[model samples]
Target: MKNLVLTFLLTVITVGSVAAQEINWVTLEEALELQKKEPKKIMIDMYTVWCGPCKMLDKNTFQNKEVAAYVNENFYAVKFNAEGNDVVSFQGKEFTNPSYDPAKASRRNSSHQLSRYFQVNAYPTIVYLDENADLIAPIKGYQTPTQIELYLKMFANNDYKTLTTQDAFNEYYLAFKPEFKG
Candidate 1:
Protein backbone atom coordinates (compact mmCIF):
# COMPACT_ATOMS: atom_id res chain seq x y z
CA MET A 1 0.00 0.00 0.00
CA LYS A 2 2.87 2.39 0.75
CA ASN A 3 4.52 1.58 -2.61
CA LEU A 4 1.28 2.31 -4.50
CA VAL A 5 0.86 5.63 -2.67
CA LEU A 6 4.44 6.59 -3.52
CA THR A 7 3.90 5.79 -7.20
CA PHE A 8 0.75 7.95 -7.33
CA LEU A 9 2.54 10.84 -5.64
CA LEU A 10 5.43 10.63 -8.12
CA THR A 11 3.02 10.61 -11.07
CA VAL A 12 1.27 13.74 -9.78
CA ILE A 13 4.55 15.55 -9.23
CA THR A 14 5.82 14.69 -12.72
CA VAL A 15 2.61 15.84 -14.39
CA GLY A 16 2.57 19.15 -12.53
CA SER A 17 6.21 19.79 -13.39
CA VAL A 18 5.62 19.06 -17.08
CA ALA A 19 2.65 21.42 -17.14
CA ALA A 20 4.74 24.26 -15.73
CA GLN A 21 7.44 23.87 -18.39
CA GLU A 22 5.42 25.61 -21.12
CA ILE A 23 5.81 29.32 -21.81
CA ASN A 24 2.46 31.10 -21.44
CA TRP A 25 2.16 32.13 -25.08
CA VAL A 26 -0.64 34.52 -25.95
CA THR A 27 -1.53 36.35 -29.18
CA LEU A 28 -0.36 39.88 -29.97
CA GLU A 29 -3.70 41.45 -29.17
CA GLU A 30 -4.01 39.37 -26.06
CA ALA A 31 -0.59 40.48 -24.83
CA LEU A 32 -1.43 44.10 -25.47
CA GLU A 33 -4.73 43.75 -23.67
CA LEU A 34 -2.97 42.04 -20.79
CA GLN A 35 -0.42 44.85 -20.67
CA LYS A 36 -3.16 47.43 -20.21
CA LYS A 37 -4.32 45.62 -17.11
CA GLU A 38 -1.00 44.51 -15.57
CA PRO A 39 1.56 46.79 -17.28
CA LYS A 40 4.22 44.15 -17.98
CA LYS A 41 6.88 44.19 -20.68
CA ILE A 42 6.16 42.18 -23.81
CA MET A 43 8.41 39.59 -25.42
CA ILE A 44 7.34 38.74 -28.95
CA ASP A 45 8.65 35.68 -30.70
CA MET A 46 8.37 36.45 -34.41
CA TYR A 47 8.64 33.20 -36.36
CA THR A 48 7.79 31.68 -39.73
CA VAL A 49 6.39 28.34 -40.76
CA TRP A 50 9.26 27.55 -43.14
CA CYS A 51 12.08 28.58 -40.81
CA GLY A 52 14.18 25.81 -39.26
CA PRO A 53 15.74 28.11 -36.66
CA CYS A 54 12.27 29.19 -35.55
CA LYS A 55 11.35 25.58 -34.86
CA MET A 56 14.61 25.04 -32.99
CA LEU A 57 13.97 28.12 -30.84
CA ASP A 58 10.53 26.80 -29.94
CA LYS A 59 11.93 23.36 -29.14
CA ASN A 60 15.13 24.35 -27.37
CA THR A 61 15.49 27.74 -25.68
CA PHE A 62 11.83 28.61 -25.29
CA GLN A 63 11.10 25.18 -23.88
CA ASN A 64 13.81 25.34 -21.22
CA LYS A 65 12.28 25.17 -17.73
CA GLU A 66 14.18 28.18 -16.42
CA VAL A 67 13.56 30.22 -19.57
CA ALA A 68 9.82 29.65 -19.48
CA ALA A 69 9.57 30.45 -15.77
CA TYR A 70 11.56 33.67 -16.04
CA VAL A 71 9.73 34.89 -19.13
CA ASN A 72 6.35 34.10 -17.62
CA GLU A 73 7.17 36.02 -14.50
CA ASN A 74 8.73 39.00 -16.27
CA PHE A 75 6.90 39.66 -19.53
CA TYR A 76 3.73 39.10 -21.50
CA ALA A 77 4.95 36.44 -23.91
CA VAL A 78 3.57 36.54 -27.49
CA LYS A 79 3.98 34.11 -30.36
CA PHE A 80 3.53 35.90 -33.67
CA ASN A 81 3.86 34.27 -37.05
CA ALA A 82 5.85 36.54 -39.35
CA GLU A 83 4.22 35.14 -42.47
CA GLY A 84 0.73 34.23 -41.39
CA ASN A 85 -2.75 35.68 -41.93
CA ASP A 86 -3.50 36.55 -38.35
CA VAL A 87 -4.95 39.98 -37.82
CA VAL A 88 -3.02 41.94 -35.22
CA SER A 89 -4.34 45.04 -33.52
CA PHE A 90 -1.32 46.95 -32.24
CA GLN A 91 -0.73 50.56 -31.29
CA GLY A 92 -4.19 51.67 -32.39
CA LYS A 93 -3.61 50.17 -35.84
CA GLU A 94 -5.13 47.07 -37.37
CA PHE A 95 -2.50 45.04 -39.21
CA THR A 96 -3.07 42.04 -41.44
CA ASN A 97 -1.41 39.99 -44.17
CA PRO A 98 -3.15 41.23 -47.27
CA SER A 99 -1.05 39.01 -49.50
CA TYR A 100 -1.21 35.83 -47.47
CA ASP A 101 -1.63 32.79 -49.71
CA PRO A 102 -3.46 29.86 -48.23
CA ALA A 103 -1.91 27.45 -50.72
CA LYS A 104 1.56 28.39 -49.49
CA ALA A 105 0.73 28.38 -45.78
CA SER A 106 3.22 25.65 -44.95
CA ARG A 107 5.92 27.14 -47.16
CA ARG A 108 7.06 30.76 -47.45
CA ASN A 109 3.96 32.91 -47.59
CA SER A 110 3.76 36.69 -47.82
CA SER A 111 4.97 38.61 -44.80
CA HIS A 112 2.36 40.08 -42.47
CA GLN A 113 2.01 43.85 -42.30
CA LEU A 114 2.92 43.77 -38.63
CA SER A 115 6.12 41.94 -39.49
CA ARG A 116 6.95 44.66 -42.01
CA TYR A 117 6.12 47.27 -39.39
CA PHE A 118 8.80 45.75 -37.18
CA GLN A 119 11.09 45.44 -40.23
CA VAL A 120 11.91 41.84 -39.42
CA ASN A 121 14.38 40.83 -42.13
CA ALA A 122 14.97 37.36 -40.72
CA TYR A 123 13.04 34.60 -39.05
CA PRO A 124 13.12 33.81 -35.30
CA THR A 125 13.43 37.46 -34.30
CA ILE A 126 12.77 38.04 -30.63
CA VAL A 127 11.28 41.52 -30.31
CA TYR A 128 11.06 43.26 -26.98
CA LEU A 129 8.64 46.02 -26.03
CA ASP A 130 8.38 48.28 -23.06
CA GLU A 131 5.49 48.16 -20.63
CA ASN A 132 3.83 50.81 -22.77
CA ALA A 133 3.95 48.49 -25.80
CA ASP A 134 6.65 50.58 -27.47
CA LEU A 135 9.39 48.90 -29.45
CA ILE A 136 12.61 48.27 -27.51
CA ALA A 137 14.84 46.13 -29.75
CA PRO A 138 14.52 43.16 -32.06
CA ILE A 139 17.18 40.49 -31.58
CA LYS A 140 17.16 38.23 -34.61
CA GLY A 141 17.96 34.49 -34.91
CA TYR A 142 18.04 31.55 -32.51
CA GLN A 143 19.26 31.95 -28.94
CA THR A 144 20.19 29.38 -26.33
CA PRO A 145 18.83 29.64 -22.78
CA THR A 146 21.91 31.50 -21.50
CA GLN A 147 22.20 33.64 -24.60
CA ILE A 148 18.59 34.80 -24.31
CA GLU A 149 18.76 35.24 -20.54
CA LEU A 150 20.96 38.31 -21.08
CA TYR A 151 18.33 40.03 -23.19
CA LEU A 152 15.51 38.73 -21.02
CA LYS A 153 16.94 40.21 -17.84
CA MET A 154 18.08 43.41 -19.54
CA PHE A 155 14.72 44.16 -21.08
CA ALA A 156 12.71 42.99 -18.09
CA ASN A 157 14.52 45.32 -15.70
CA ASN A 158 14.86 48.19 -18.21
CA ASP A 159 18.65 47.92 -18.09
CA TYR A 160 18.95 48.43 -21.85
CA LYS A 161 18.11 52.13 -21.42
CA THR A 162 21.15 52.73 -19.26
CA LEU A 163 23.61 50.81 -21.42
CA THR A 164 23.95 53.59 -23.98
CA THR A 165 27.40 52.90 -25.39
CA GLN A 166 28.80 49.69 -26.84
CA ASP A 167 31.46 49.64 -24.15
CA ALA A 168 28.84 49.94 -21.43
CA PHE A 169 26.86 47.13 -23.02
CA ASN A 170 29.97 45.00 -23.16
CA GLU A 171 30.65 45.63 -19.50
CA TYR A 172 27.14 44.62 -18.56
CA TYR A 173 27.34 41.57 -20.80
CA LEU A 174 30.55 40.46 -19.16
CA ALA A 175 29.30 41.08 -15.64
CA PHE A 176 25.87 39.57 -16.12
CA LYS A 177 25.75 36.05 -14.61
CA PRO A 178 23.12 34.03 -16.42
CA GLU A 179 20.75 32.11 -14.15
CA PHE A 180 18.93 30.24 -16.92
CA LYS A 181 20.18 26.76 -17.71
CA GLY A 182 21.34 26.16 -21.28
Candidate 2:
Protein backbone atom coordinates (compact mmCIF):
# COMPACT_ATOMS: atom_id res chain seq x y z
CA MET A 1 0.00 0.00 0.00
CA LYS A 2 2.80 2.43 0.83
CA ASN A 3 4.68 1.68 -2.40
CA LEU A 4 1.53 2.08 -4.47
CA VAL A 5 0.77 5.47 -2.90
CA LEU A 6 4.33 6.65 -3.44
CA THR A 7 4.26 5.56 -7.08
CA PHE A 8 1.02 7.38 -7.70
CA LEU A 9 2.39 10.55 -6.12
CA LEU A 10 5.52 10.35 -8.29
CA THR A 11 3.42 9.91 -11.43
CA VAL A 12 1.31 12.92 -10.58
CA ILE A 13 4.37 15.04 -9.94
CA THR A 14 5.94 14.05 -13.26
CA VAL A 15 2.79 14.87 -15.20
CA GLY A 16 2.43 18.21 -13.45
CA SER A 17 6.00 19.15 -14.31
CA VAL A 18 5.47 18.22 -17.97
CA ALA A 19 2.31 20.31 -18.14
CA ALA A 20 4.12 23.26 -16.58
CA GLN A 21 6.71 23.09 -19.36
CA GLU A 22 4.12 24.35 -21.84
CA ILE A 23 4.63 27.94 -22.99
CA ASN A 24 2.83 30.64 -21.04
CA TRP A 25 1.90 33.03 -23.83
CA VAL A 26 1.31 36.72 -23.10
CA THR A 27 -0.78 39.34 -24.87
CA LEU A 28 1.05 41.85 -27.08
CA GLU A 29 0.55 44.60 -24.50
CA GLU A 30 1.91 42.40 -21.74
CA ALA A 31 4.92 41.56 -23.90
CA LEU A 32 5.63 45.23 -24.41
CA GLU A 33 5.53 45.80 -20.68
CA LEU A 34 8.07 43.02 -20.15
CA GLN A 35 10.26 44.42 -22.92
CA LYS A 36 10.61 47.72 -21.09
CA LYS A 37 12.36 45.94 -18.22
CA GLU A 38 14.44 43.46 -20.22
CA PRO A 39 16.19 43.34 -23.57
CA LYS A 40 14.74 39.95 -24.59
CA LYS A 41 13.24 39.75 -28.06
CA ILE A 42 9.61 38.89 -28.83
CA MET A 43 8.14 36.05 -30.88
CA ILE A 44 4.55 36.20 -32.06
CA ASP A 45 2.71 33.18 -33.34
CA MET A 46 0.11 34.72 -35.64
CA TYR A 47 -2.64 32.15 -35.96
CA THR A 48 -6.32 31.74 -36.70
CA VAL A 49 -8.73 29.07 -35.43
CA TRP A 50 -9.43 27.87 -38.98
CA CYS A 51 -5.82 27.46 -40.06
CA GLY A 52 -5.02 23.74 -40.14
CA PRO A 53 -1.28 24.19 -40.45
CA CYS A 54 -1.28 26.66 -37.58
CA LYS A 55 -2.91 24.05 -35.40
CA MET A 56 -0.30 21.51 -36.43
CA LEU A 57 2.50 23.98 -35.72
CA ASP A 58 1.12 24.65 -32.26
CA LYS A 59 0.68 20.96 -31.47
CA ASN A 60 3.85 19.66 -33.10
CA THR A 61 6.44 22.41 -33.28
CA PHE A 62 5.75 24.85 -30.45
CA GLN A 63 4.79 22.08 -28.03
CA ASN A 64 8.06 20.24 -28.33
CA LYS A 65 9.95 20.41 -25.04
CA GLU A 66 13.11 21.82 -26.61
CA VAL A 67 11.18 24.40 -28.60
CA ALA A 68 9.11 25.45 -25.61
CA ALA A 69 12.16 25.72 -23.38
CA TYR A 70 14.11 27.77 -25.90
CA VAL A 71 11.25 30.15 -26.59
CA ASN A 72 10.45 30.61 -22.91
CA GLU A 73 14.07 31.31 -22.12
CA ASN A 74 14.72 33.75 -24.95
CA PHE A 75 11.48 35.46 -25.92
CA TYR A 76 8.30 37.00 -24.67
CA ALA A 77 6.12 34.60 -26.67
CA VAL A 78 2.72 35.86 -27.85
CA LYS A 79 -0.11 33.93 -29.49
CA PHE A 80 -2.05 36.46 -31.56
CA ASN A 81 -5.28 35.37 -33.19
CA ALA A 82 -5.31 37.07 -36.57
CA GLU A 83 -9.05 37.57 -36.41
CA GLY A 84 -9.54 37.97 -32.70
CA ASN A 85 -11.85 40.61 -31.27
CA ASP A 86 -9.39 42.02 -28.81
CA VAL A 87 -8.10 45.55 -29.32
CA VAL A 88 -4.29 45.55 -29.48
CA SER A 89 -2.50 48.74 -28.52
CA PHE A 90 0.97 49.35 -29.86
CA GLN A 91 3.04 52.45 -30.36
CA GLY A 92 0.27 54.70 -29.02
CA LYS A 93 -2.30 53.20 -31.38
CA GLU A 94 -5.17 50.74 -30.98
CA PHE A 95 -5.79 48.19 -33.74
CA THR A 96 -9.02 46.28 -34.19
CA ASN A 97 -11.26 44.87 -36.90
CA PRO A 98 -13.97 47.51 -36.98
CA SER A 99 -15.46 45.99 -40.16
CA TYR A 100 -15.57 42.43 -38.82
CA ASP A 101 -18.69 40.48 -39.73
CA PRO A 102 -19.86 38.12 -37.04
CA ALA A 103 -22.28 36.34 -39.42
CA LYS A 104 -19.55 34.87 -41.59
CA ALA A 105 -17.79 32.91 -38.90
CA SER A 106 -15.72 30.84 -41.28
CA ARG A 107 -14.42 33.80 -43.21
CA ARG A 108 -11.82 35.96 -41.47
CA ASN A 109 -12.93 39.28 -40.07
CA SER A 110 -11.32 42.47 -41.22
CA SER A 111 -7.72 41.94 -40.21
CA HIS A 112 -6.41 43.80 -37.18
CA GLN A 113 -4.67 46.99 -38.22
CA LEU A 114 -1.49 45.54 -36.72
CA SER A 115 -1.68 42.68 -39.22
CA ARG A 116 -1.68 45.23 -41.98
CA TYR A 117 0.99 47.16 -40.10
CA PHE A 118 3.21 44.09 -40.20
CA GLN A 119 2.03 43.09 -43.69
CA VAL A 120 0.82 39.67 -42.55
CA ASN A 121 -0.99 38.40 -45.67
CA ALA A 122 -1.10 34.68 -44.82
CA TYR A 123 -1.90 32.38 -41.95
CA PRO A 124 0.65 30.90 -39.55
CA THR A 125 2.96 33.85 -39.84
CA ILE A 126 5.64 34.11 -37.15
CA VAL A 127 6.67 37.66 -36.40
CA TYR A 128 9.79 38.43 -34.43
CA LEU A 129 10.34 41.81 -32.87
CA ASP A 130 13.12 43.58 -31.06
CA GLU A 131 12.90 44.70 -27.45
CA ASN A 132 11.55 48.05 -28.61
CA ALA A 133 8.69 46.25 -30.43
CA ASP A 134 10.07 47.15 -33.82
CA LEU A 135 9.48 44.61 -36.59
CA ILE A 136 12.50 42.38 -36.92
CA ALA A 137 10.99 40.23 -39.65
CA PRO A 138 7.81 38.39 -40.42
CA ILE A 139 8.35 34.73 -41.24
CA LYS A 140 5.54 33.26 -43.33
CA GLY A 141 4.41 29.61 -43.39
CA TYR A 142 4.63 26.72 -40.99
CA GLN A 143 7.98 25.66 -39.62
CA THR A 144 9.04 22.42 -38.02
CA PRO A 145 10.55 22.56 -34.52
CA THR A 146 14.01 21.90 -35.87
CA GLN A 147 13.59 24.52 -38.58
CA ILE A 148 12.43 27.13 -36.08
CA GLU A 149 15.28 26.55 -33.62
CA LEU A 150 17.61 28.30 -36.05
CA TYR A 151 15.54 31.47 -36.05
CA LEU A 152 15.24 31.36 -32.27
CA LYS A 153 18.98 31.15 -31.89
CA MET A 154 19.62 33.82 -34.49
CA PHE A 155 17.39 36.39 -32.84
CA ALA A 156 18.30 35.32 -29.32
CA ASN A 157 21.97 35.89 -30.07
CA ASN A 158 21.34 39.20 -31.92
CA ASP A 159 22.94 37.71 -35.05
CA TYR A 160 20.56 39.52 -37.37
CA LYS A 161 22.39 42.80 -36.80
CA THR A 162 25.50 41.38 -38.42
CA LEU A 163 24.11 39.42 -41.38
CA THR A 164 23.56 41.52 -44.50
CA THR A 165 21.19 39.15 -46.33
CA GLN A 166 18.92 36.16 -45.91
CA ASP A 167 21.20 34.08 -48.10
CA ALA A 168 24.08 34.60 -45.72
CA PHE A 169 21.88 33.70 -42.79
CA ASN A 170 20.61 30.64 -44.65
CA GLU A 171 24.18 29.50 -45.19
CA TYR A 172 24.91 29.87 -41.50
CA TYR A 173 21.69 28.07 -40.59
CA LEU A 174 22.50 25.16 -42.89
CA ALA A 175 25.86 24.75 -41.22
CA PHE A 176 24.50 24.95 -37.66
CA LYS A 177 22.84 22.38 -35.44
CA PRO A 178 20.83 22.93 -32.29
CA GLU A 179 22.59 22.05 -29.03
CA PHE A 180 19.32 21.67 -27.15
CA LYS A 181 17.87 18.18 -26.81
CA GLY A 182 14.22 17.40 -27.51
Candidate 3:
Protein backbone atom coordinates (compact mmCIF):
# COMPACT_ATOMS: atom_id res chain seq x y z
CA MET A 1 0.00 0.00 0.00
CA LYS A 2 2.83 2.42 0.87
CA ASN A 3 4.70 1.67 -2.37
CA LEU A 4 1.55 2.10 -4.48
CA VAL A 5 0.80 5.46 -2.91
CA LEU A 6 4.37 6.64 -3.47
CA THR A 7 4.22 5.59 -7.12
CA PHE A 8 0.95 7.48 -7.70
CA LEU A 9 2.34 10.62 -6.05
CA LEU A 10 5.50 10.45 -8.15
CA THR A 11 3.49 10.05 -11.34
CA VAL A 12 1.34 13.10 -10.52
CA ILE A 13 4.40 15.21 -9.71
CA THR A 14 6.17 14.22 -12.94
CA VAL A 15 3.13 14.95 -15.09
CA GLY A 16 2.57 18.34 -13.50
CA SER A 17 6.22 19.29 -13.91
CA VAL A 18 6.19 18.39 -17.61
CA ALA A 19 3.00 20.36 -18.12
CA ALA A 20 4.46 23.42 -16.42
CA GLN A 21 7.62 23.30 -18.55
CA GLU A 22 5.73 23.73 -21.81
CA ILE A 23 5.84 27.18 -23.47
CA ASN A 24 2.26 27.97 -24.40
CA TRP A 25 2.61 29.41 -27.91
CA VAL A 26 -0.30 31.40 -29.24
CA THR A 27 -0.91 33.00 -32.65
CA LEU A 28 -0.10 36.69 -33.11
CA GLU A 29 -3.74 37.69 -33.31
CA GLU A 30 -4.64 35.57 -30.30
CA ALA A 31 -1.72 37.04 -28.35
CA LEU A 32 -2.88 40.56 -29.18
CA GLU A 33 -6.43 39.73 -28.15
CA LEU A 34 -5.22 38.17 -24.90
CA GLN A 35 -3.15 41.28 -24.14
CA LYS A 36 -6.34 43.34 -24.09
CA LYS A 37 -7.48 41.32 -21.09
CA GLU A 38 -4.16 40.58 -19.40
CA PRO A 39 -1.05 42.40 -20.62
CA LYS A 40 2.39 40.85 -20.98
CA LYS A 41 5.47 41.25 -23.11
CA ILE A 42 5.49 39.24 -26.36
CA MET A 43 8.29 37.18 -27.87
CA ILE A 44 8.10 36.26 -31.54
CA ASP A 45 10.08 33.29 -32.83
CA MET A 46 10.46 34.27 -36.46
CA TYR A 47 11.55 31.46 -38.73
CA THR A 48 11.16 29.88 -42.17
CA VAL A 49 10.13 26.29 -42.85
CA TRP A 50 13.38 25.50 -44.64
CA CYS A 51 15.75 27.12 -42.16
CA GLY A 52 18.07 24.61 -40.44
CA PRO A 53 19.18 26.83 -37.59
CA CYS A 54 15.57 27.66 -36.88
CA LYS A 55 14.85 23.96 -36.43
CA MET A 56 17.87 23.66 -34.17
CA LEU A 57 16.69 26.52 -32.00
CA ASP A 58 13.21 24.99 -31.76
CA LYS A 59 14.53 21.54 -30.91
CA ASN A 60 17.31 22.59 -28.56
CA THR A 61 16.79 26.01 -27.02
CA PHE A 62 13.01 26.37 -27.06
CA GLN A 63 12.60 22.86 -25.75
CA ASN A 64 14.92 23.45 -22.81
CA LYS A 65 13.08 23.21 -19.50
CA GLU A 66 14.29 26.51 -18.05
CA VAL A 67 13.86 28.33 -21.37
CA ALA A 68 10.33 27.00 -21.81
CA ALA A 69 9.25 27.87 -18.25
CA TYR A 70 10.66 31.42 -18.24
CA VAL A 71 9.31 32.33 -21.69
CA ASN A 72 5.91 30.84 -20.82
CA GLU A 73 5.68 32.90 -17.65
CA ASN A 74 7.04 36.22 -18.96
CA PHE A 75 5.85 36.47 -22.58
CA TYR A 76 3.04 35.56 -24.88
CA ALA A 77 5.17 33.49 -27.28
CA VAL A 78 4.36 33.50 -31.00
CA LYS A 79 5.83 31.03 -33.48
CA PHE A 80 5.65 33.06 -36.65
CA ASN A 81 6.73 31.51 -39.92
CA ALA A 82 8.56 34.27 -41.76
CA GLU A 83 7.81 32.84 -45.19
CA GLY A 84 4.30 31.53 -44.55
CA ASN A 85 0.80 32.71 -45.41
CA ASP A 86 -0.35 33.78 -41.99
CA VAL A 87 -1.74 37.32 -41.95
CA VAL A 88 -0.76 39.28 -38.87
CA SER A 89 -2.29 42.59 -37.83
CA PHE A 90 -0.04 44.93 -35.88
CA GLN A 91 -0.14 48.62 -35.14
CA GLY A 92 -3.23 49.26 -37.26
CA LYS A 93 -1.74 47.44 -40.27
CA GLU A 94 -2.34 44.03 -41.82
CA PHE A 95 0.69 42.05 -43.05
CA THR A 96 0.67 38.98 -45.28
CA ASN A 97 2.73 36.88 -47.67
CA PRO A 98 1.18 37.85 -50.99
CA SER A 99 3.60 35.80 -53.05
CA TYR A 100 3.73 32.72 -50.86
CA ASP A 101 3.37 29.61 -53.02
CA PRO A 102 1.09 26.96 -51.58
CA ALA A 103 2.98 24.10 -53.24
CA LYS A 104 6.22 25.23 -51.59
CA ALA A 105 4.81 25.49 -48.08
CA SER A 106 7.54 23.25 -46.65
CA ARG A 107 10.27 24.94 -48.65
CA ARG A 108 11.25 28.58 -49.08
CA ASN A 109 8.23 30.69 -49.97
CA SER A 110 7.74 34.43 -50.25
CA SER A 111 8.58 36.32 -47.09
CA HIS A 112 5.63 37.58 -45.04
CA GLN A 113 5.08 41.34 -44.99
CA LEU A 114 5.47 41.30 -41.22
CA SER A 115 8.96 39.83 -41.59
CA ARG A 116 9.80 42.63 -43.99
CA TYR A 117 8.17 45.14 -41.66
CA PHE A 118 10.48 44.00 -38.87
CA GLN A 119 13.44 43.91 -41.34
CA VAL A 120 14.10 40.25 -40.65
CA ASN A 121 16.47 39.33 -43.49
CA ALA A 122 17.69 36.21 -41.72
CA TYR A 123 16.22 33.12 -40.16
CA PRO A 124 15.55 32.54 -36.43
CA THR A 125 15.08 36.17 -35.49
CA ILE A 126 13.67 36.60 -32.00
CA VAL A 127 11.50 39.74 -32.02
CA TYR A 128 10.54 41.16 -28.67
CA LEU A 129 7.62 43.51 -28.11
CA ASP A 130 6.69 45.53 -25.05
CA GLU A 131 3.44 44.98 -23.16
CA ASN A 132 1.95 47.79 -25.30
CA ALA A 133 2.75 45.75 -28.47
CA ASP A 134 5.55 48.12 -29.47
CA LEU A 135 8.74 46.71 -30.98
CA ILE A 136 11.59 46.47 -28.51
CA ALA A 137 14.22 44.75 -30.70
CA PRO A 138 14.57 42.16 -33.45
CA ILE A 139 17.55 39.98 -32.60
CA LYS A 140 18.72 37.95 -35.60
CA GLY A 141 20.23 34.45 -35.82
CA TYR A 142 20.06 31.24 -33.82
CA GLN A 143 20.67 31.47 -30.09
CA THR A 144 21.39 28.74 -27.55
CA PRO A 145 19.19 28.31 -24.48
CA THR A 146 21.79 30.10 -22.34
CA GLN A 147 22.23 32.90 -24.88
CA ILE A 148 18.49 33.57 -25.17
CA GLU A 149 17.95 33.22 -21.41
CA LEU A 150 19.84 36.50 -20.88
CA TYR A 151 17.70 38.49 -23.33
CA LEU A 152 14.53 36.92 -21.88
CA LYS A 153 15.49 38.04 -18.39
CA MET A 154 16.73 41.45 -19.52
CA PHE A 155 13.51 42.34 -21.30
CA ALA A 156 11.23 40.65 -18.77
CA ASN A 157 12.79 42.53 -15.85
CA ASN A 158 12.84 45.88 -17.73
CA ASP A 159 16.64 45.94 -17.38
CA TYR A 160 16.87 47.17 -20.95
CA LYS A 161 15.63 50.56 -19.75
CA THR A 162 18.89 51.27 -17.94
CA LEU A 163 21.28 50.19 -20.70
CA THR A 164 21.42 53.40 -22.75
CA THR A 165 25.01 53.28 -24.00
CA GLN A 166 26.92 50.55 -25.83
CA ASP A 167 29.28 50.36 -22.87
CA ALA A 168 26.41 49.83 -20.49
CA PHE A 169 25.02 47.04 -22.63
CA ASN A 170 28.45 45.46 -22.80
CA GLU A 171 28.77 45.61 -19.03
CA TYR A 172 25.38 44.05 -18.60
CA TYR A 173 26.19 41.32 -21.08
CA LEU A 174 29.46 40.54 -19.37
CA ALA A 175 27.83 40.28 -15.97
CA PHE A 176 24.89 38.07 -17.03
CA LYS A 177 24.91 34.61 -15.43
CA PRO A 178 23.09 31.98 -17.43
CA GLU A 179 20.85 29.54 -15.52
CA PHE A 180 19.57 27.49 -18.48
CA LYS A 181 21.12 24.04 -18.24
CA GLY A 182 19.95 22.74 -21.61
The lDDT values for all models are 0.93, 0.86, 0.92
| Number of the top-ranking candidate, with TM-score as the measure | 1
Q: Which is the winner by TM-score between candidate 1 and candidate 2?
A: 1
For each of the candidates, the C-alpha root-mean-square deviation to the true structure, in angstroms, is: 2.8, 2.7, 3.5
Poorest 10 consecutive residues by lDDT, candidate 3: 15-24
Model 2 Cα lDDT, one tens digit per residue, 74-99: 99999998877778889999898777
Clashes of 3: 0
- Per-residue lDDT tens digits for candidate 1, residues 1-182, read 99999999999999998876889999888898898899999999999999999999999999898999999999999999999999878888999999999999999999999988987989999989999989999999999999999999999988999999999999999999998777
What is the TM-score of candidate 2? 0.88
TM-score of candidate 3 versus the correct structure, residues matched by position: 0.89
Clashes by residue pair, model 2: none
Error of 2 at 49 (Å): 1.0
Q: Clash totals for all models, in order?
A: 0, 0, 0
Error in Å for residue 149 of model 1: 0.2
Structure candidate 3, residue pairs in collision: none
- Tens-place lDDT per residue, model 3, 62-127, is 988889989988999999999999877888998988998999998989889999988899999999
